[model samples]
Target: MTLPTPLTGVVPPVCTPLTPDNEVDVGSLTRLVDHLVTAGVDALFVLGSSSEAAYLPDRHRRTVVDTVTGHVAGQLPVLAGAIDMTTLRVRDHVVAVTAAGADAVVTTAPFYTRTHPAEIATHFREVAAASPVPLFAYDLPVSVHTKLGADLLLDLAAEGVLAGVKDSSGDEGTFRRVLLGTRARADITDFSVLTGAELTVDSALAMGADGVVPGLGNVDPEGYVRLYRYCRSGDWARARAEQERLCGLFAMTAVGDPSRMGGSSSALGAFKAALHLRGVIDCPATAVPQVPLSSGEVERVGKYLAAAGLL
Candidate 1:
């Protein structure tokens, strides 16, 4: 399927489901896809941060893309993340996911090795040249350790090197600048600027963002969809209410004790737990090495769900 020129609406960064043995749970993943699609999301983003793409092995990544793209069957755009440490490695992932039927590929700036802005621009251009499908830059400085500059992003957008960007850098100032630049620059057209921040969807949309790629959307797709519709219709009052409610639900990510587990363990574990409690997926287990949420923490997740009326 051809990606929407300016992809809009709620696009959930999907969560990967795993079995006890740490293998990809195809059945659970399919159900999770159905849950999101049925909730009126515009597209599905697999192998994103929410999907634990960084931790997934190459084989597991391939299986995830194949499973989701096959199950979606063109019902909506299936964007797979070609997340890696550098240009060449990201290119290989791009090839793998596109061959597995992904409609587009999302990638972050090169990491682990220190890189200059010139090298970052060169990296994206090189990957875009090699990719068989549309490429969306994933601006996640928390992991990549380098924030994307709005000027550089706009320059690339003008040159057609990037189809869109998923900004997860948590820099509202830069995010708003990019949004405004995308709108004001005559040279940059048909570029989709999506937010990967869950708690700021309303503010992002108000700032001319094209859409949202909220990981929390995996747990409460309907809420995000409603928030999107409210924003598009100019219902600020209703949109704010819904967004605040969703933000309350998002507090589940902190249910796990910080001293006991890492951020990935707490956030992803809470999401999978919510999905399991909602009966959308079978198992709530995350990948290996990441600690599981304690039973009490899982209960805390349930409380958040119940408060949000997801239970």
Candidate 2:
């Protein structure tokens, strides 16, 4: 059950494929895992933000973990999100996902309730103390509404309260600060710094990030794998080219008219639609309450795919 201390390479926060009736689409999911496995992704992340973790019930969340971990069969390490509004709830999720076969747990600070840094620190320490597997802090201010400062992260890393960070805060300065902070510490040799910014993998890698958890990687894992390899080999030109192509493909996320749906719907819908068009999944349906893409939006996604040479 051991993962590389500083887990590296492309790890897409996998998208949850749903049936029209809003159930987890098992067949599509296993096939998606098979697709990522074939593409040579370093690991699998099943129930993160990209996986619609916010929308799933406890039973469905467990089903997702069981399905992905069971199908993966130990081919790659699996990390599941243990997100909630408080310490006890997150600890319960940590217990559930790990018991269901998650190799590690990624969690965020308490949300939906105002909290202090002291409370947040206590929350992480208590949660980590209760977990069997390694715990990673997830710094996604957009959803959690609390940005994890570099000082706090480094302090946590120093104390061994966190295995790594999955950062989606879009703050490049803090990203570099975390990377620099970790390298400066002789004892913090294995703390990973993974960026969730899909558009900037090349920049992130060049600046010494450990890896990426790009949501767009779900639609194109091989592209990210190639990009990561290019960066590792110091092939800046090729990496830039690959990243530019992916950036263009990412425009599909904006096809869902802003007036009609939120950015989350646009992005997740585009990923699923692209996956369906790529023949990697069946029924590009997202969960309920998130507006689905329109016929026009789906066609726009197909055009982006065609342009990206994915269709």
Candidate 3:
């Protein structure tokens, strides 16, 4: 596998703002990108899970890629996530985003099928071959249930396709194993490993993770930047403190339902609403079936943001 150059810093999986009519809000997107850049975010990852990528259509997804890349310019590297389950469709998305000037592609493992290790390798191999830019192996086994084994990663590294893997499974043991196995290897020139879970970001950094890719950064950009810088600087105490504050803002994501804070339509809506309240964007809307946050949820999230000094 082709190793990605050492990628350091906190890269947020930014959320996509939408118009009331369910169309992508280019204006809001520009505002959001500007907000993140001004807040000192290292990079912007578009069309990620936090962005509701799975619910977006191809046309809108392409528009998001162009909007984010064009707005960010070359100030920060912009990586776009490829969410289509079909390899052919994902390949097409990679080609599309690459043409749109994305720095790289972050793709999840196959979702519909129970992908075996071998199939995962094959899938990524095909996607890497088709993608003009490098591909980041997305390992969100919680959502897809296919953990990217260390042996498979080593094998893929041997084949020279992947740039790195995003370990979002939140399995510390698995993460440690991957790190130990890949750290001493000299064959994988650019294999960078990124931690995907937000709660474990500080711990992941302390464990020598290449970088952090968290969803919470979409709303609390400055807090995430501060937390990440602290971690990268090896200040666990300050990092932990900032993480606690970050978690407070993240609490707003559970305004409607505390049990399922993330991956909920309302939670995402709450995040966008919080961003809107903070004046970063306008029109806090979601796609079909998932409307904007309820009045109470919005109020709660707004209050939470205010408490966190974000609004």
lDDT of every model, 2 decimals: 0.94, 0.93, 0.81
| Residue range 1-311, candidate 1, lDDT tens digits | 99999888899999999998999999999999999999999999999999999889999999999999999999999999999999999999999999999999999999999999999999999999999888999999999899999998999999999999999999998988888898889999999999988998998999899999999999999999999999999999999999999989999999888898999899999999999999998899988799999999999999999999989
Clash pairs for candidate 1: none
lDDT of 1 at 258: 85
Better of 2 and 3 by TM-score: 2
Model 1: residues with Cα > 4 Å off, grouped in runs = none
Residue range with the least summed lDDT across 10 consecutive positions in model 3? 257-266
Q: On residues 183-301, what C-alpha lDDT tens digit does candidate 2 reach at each position?
A: 89877868999999989999999999989999999999999999999999999999999999999999999998889889999999999999999998899988879899999999999
User: Candidate 3, 190: how far from true, in Å?
Assistant: 2.4
TM-score of 3: 0.93
What TM-score does each of the candidates earn? 0.99, 0.99, 0.93
In candidate 2, the residue pairs with backbone N, CA or C atoms under 3 Å apart (3 or more residues apart, or in different chains) clash, namely none
- Angstrom error of the Cα, residue 117, model 1: value is 0.3
Candidate 2 lDDT score relative to the true structure: 0.93
What lDDT is reached at residue 134 by model 1?
Answer: 89
Task: Provide the lowest-lDDT 10-residue window in model 1.
Answer: 175-184
